[model samples]
Target: MKVLVTGAAGSIGRVVTVGLAELGHVVVGLDRVPQPDGEDSAWHTVDATDADAVAAVFEEESPDAVVHLAGHPGEASLPDSLTSHVVTTGALLDAMVEHDVRRLVYASSNHAVGRTPRGGPPEAGPVGADARLRPDTFYGVAKVAAEALMSLYADRYGIDAVACRIGSFLERPETVRHLATWLSPDDCVRMVAAALTAPAPGFAVLYGISHNTRAWWDLAPGRALGYEPRDDAEDFAGIIEARPEDEAEAAHVGGPYATAQFERPALDRTS
Candidate 1:
């Protein structure tokens, strides 16, 4: 299948593109920014916010599936949180509809439901997908909007949309938080592959995390996606936890992205 990956220069995007290529799928990379200093791909640098640009890229590439990953990643203090949501993703939606793309895997975040009840380990079983979306930051708000757009497109335009609320993607599972919610890079690819080919995924928003000991969210259809994660956070427990608290404080911040301000004013985050 020909796949288009937006934000092809990003951490996951870069890996996903190469992974797709290795899987024998043709990849057309899209990004608003140019290739990073040394990174590379079949890149087409187009601002995700531009409708015509996105449309042109989609029309030219005509990929069978589009994994929308292009957007400003969350930061502690974002200058504008809504730009990526309203501009980048919104434009991509229009392009998808215009080009008659079939499957679209939107990169939603765990924070989409972060405001829900999360007390113990994440592996205790998920708090539930139906948990009301109470976004704690402007970035979360954008993800919520992106999910809504996927729904609208799926229902109204016959687009097969899946909003994957992804968990942590860490090199090692060191702290208590990652054990329950780690999303290894390989698992990430598998999840996307599964979502793309799943029998009858009818407008779904599935959690994107691996099966781990301390999980709070249940990974249901994730299995159906044929995703069996090989990497577990527990493997690194001995090493990561080997250090004491003060030494691991930064590492223990739940997820690397939990601190994301999503380019919004720091004063607006839900503390």
Candidate 2:
């Protein structure tokens, strides 16, 4: 299948592009970042916030699947950050619609439900897919809006939308919170690939997290997507020390990222 990965130069987008190619799909890398003169990527330079430009690429490529990863990422500085991110995501959806393209694997975030309490005790059963969208920050708000767009495009336009509410994707499973939420690079590849190829994923919001002992994000709806996450953080528990009790307290909470420096967040959301 032909695939288009917007924001292909970004951390996660790069991986997704390469991963799809390795899986034998023809992949095109789209980004505002200028491509090298003789690049291997079927690269295109376009602003995601400009629907006209984005649509032109989609129309030209006519990709069977689109992994919408491009956006002006949110920052904690209130309204300015929100404007950039919210506007960019809107452009992404409008363009996708204009082309009559379906099968979109949206790159959403755990922050969409980050404010929900993370239970210390295991719930009787896993969390449901119908959980509320209670975001903790402007960043999370943008994700919620984007996820809503996916729903609208799928239900109203007869498209297939898989909003992967991705958890943390780290280079190494270090922090205690990461042990529960870590989505390794390989697992990231698997989740996105599953969402793209799923026969029928009509308007679904599924968590993109690996199997770990402390995981709180629900994965029940992801079964239809065929996402069998293979990595586990437990194997590295002994090598990484936990954060101090106070820091761990905040980080282990569902709002762990609430403590994150919004002005210059250290965490890599793109991953």
Candidate 3:
């Protein structure tokens, strides 16, 4: 399968692009910046926000699927968040519609349910993928909105869309909270590959995390889609630094994103 990955120069994108290629899928990369040195995937210098540029890439590459990892990766004002997440998604979906691309594997975030109180193991079962949205910040809200768009497109157009609400994607578990939330680089690739090849998953949401013993989110949804994550964050638990704020961060599924530090005015009035 020929796959197009946006944000190809990013941390996760870089991993996914190379990983997919290693899995024998023809990989094509798209990003606003120039492709990094030593990388061999077919590269396109185009911002995802520009519908025309995205469309042009779709027409030229004619990919079988897309792994959308574009847009701002951090908190922003509401409008900026919408543009970075929603608008960019809209452009890709529109391009997919035009180009007849059938599959999309989105890089959604755990913050889409950031405000949900942590409950799993002793207290209750892990949070299911069908849990209601409790977005922690503008960034989370944008993710929810983008997901709604994917659902709409899936239903109306018969496009197979899979939204993976990724947890803390890191090289290794660095903190106590990460013990339950870390998504290993290898697992991230596995998740995307499964989402890409799952047979006719019309519209699905799956938590993106490794097979961690301390996981707070259910992996059943991902497993249903053939995403069998292998890494377990608990393997590195002994090396993780436990900080005083770990309890507070673990209070909600979104960690510190649900806290006051991310609370900002809806609009940037000064700008």
Candidate 4:
């Protein structure tokens, strides 16, 4: 299968692109950042928000699947962030429709349900795709809107959309919260590959996390996509200091991003 990976130079993108190529899929990597030579994938520089540019790529590549990961990755002030996420996502969806590309693996975030309380009853288990939207920041809100766009396209255009509510995707667990939330790079590729190959995913929202013992998110939805995560954060659980249950970060599913103040510094606005 031929695959187009947007934001293909980012941390997760790099892993996914290489993993897809190793699996024998032709991978075309698109990003504003130019990739170094000798990579397994073919790279192209394109700002995602540009509809015409994105359409041209779609027209040219005509890929069998797309893993949409390009966006303003972190929480930021209005316009620029919105353009990077929502606007760019809209452009991609439109281009997908125009080019008749049916399969999409959207990079949604756990922050889409950021306000949910963590550590519920042990038997209750973690939240699933049916979890309510509780965006904790503008960035999360943008993901919410993009998810809606995916739904619209899937319903009206027969697009097979898989929205992955990804947790803290990192190479390693950095903080205490990450023990439950961290999604290893290998697991990230596994999940994306599942999304790409799933038989009939019309429109589904699924969690993207590893098989962590203390995971606060469910894996059942991901299983439907053929994802079987192998890495577990608990392997390094003894090394990282655990935060007390009473800490604010331990209380919400969003972690520190849930409570961060978003006021823009004066110097930042001048840029």
Best by lDDT: 3
Q: Which of 1 and 4 is the better model by TM-score?
A: 4
User: Candidate 2: which stretches are off by over 4 Å?
Assistant: 36-39, 72-74, 78-85, 124-126, 245-255, 260-271
Which 10-residue window in model 4 sums to the lowest lDDT? 262-271
Residue-wise C-alpha lDDT for candidate 3, range 79-138, written one tens digit per residue: 999999999999999999999999999999999999999754575788888898999999
The lowest-lDDT stretch of 10 consecutive residues in candidate 2 is: 246-255
Root-mean-square deviation of each candidate, in angstroms?
A: 4.3, 4.7, 1.2, 2.5
TM-score of each: 0.84, 0.87, 0.98, 0.93
- Per-residue CA lDDT of candidate 4, range 1-271, in tens? 9999999998888888899898899999999989856684677799988899989899888888899999978987656667878898888889988888889998999989887887678777688789889887777777888899899999999999999999989888977888889899999989999999999899998889899998888999999789999999999888887566327776788877677564343223544
Rate residue 176 of model 4 by lDDT: 82
Off by over 4 Å in 1: 36-41, 75-79, 120-125, 242-271
Error of 2 at 217 (Å): 1.2
**Candidate 3 C-alpha error for residue 177, in Å:** 0.4
Q: Write the per-residue lDDT of candidate 2 for residues 1-271, one digit (tens) a residue.
A: 9988887888788788888899999999888898645559688898777778878888888888788787654445445445455566666667667876777887888878776665445644445568777776777877887777677767788888888887877766877777777888898999999999888778888888887776667666776679988788887788877556435334423445555443354343656
Candidate 3 Cα misplacement greater than 4 A, ranges: 119-123
What lDDT score belongs to each candidate, Candidate 1 first?
Answer: 0.73, 0.75, 0.94, 0.86
* Model 2 global lDDT (CA atoms, 0 to 1): 0.75
Best by TM-score: 3
Q: Looking at candidate 3, what is the lDDT of residue 46?
A: 97
lDDT minimum window of 10 residues, candidate 3: 118-127
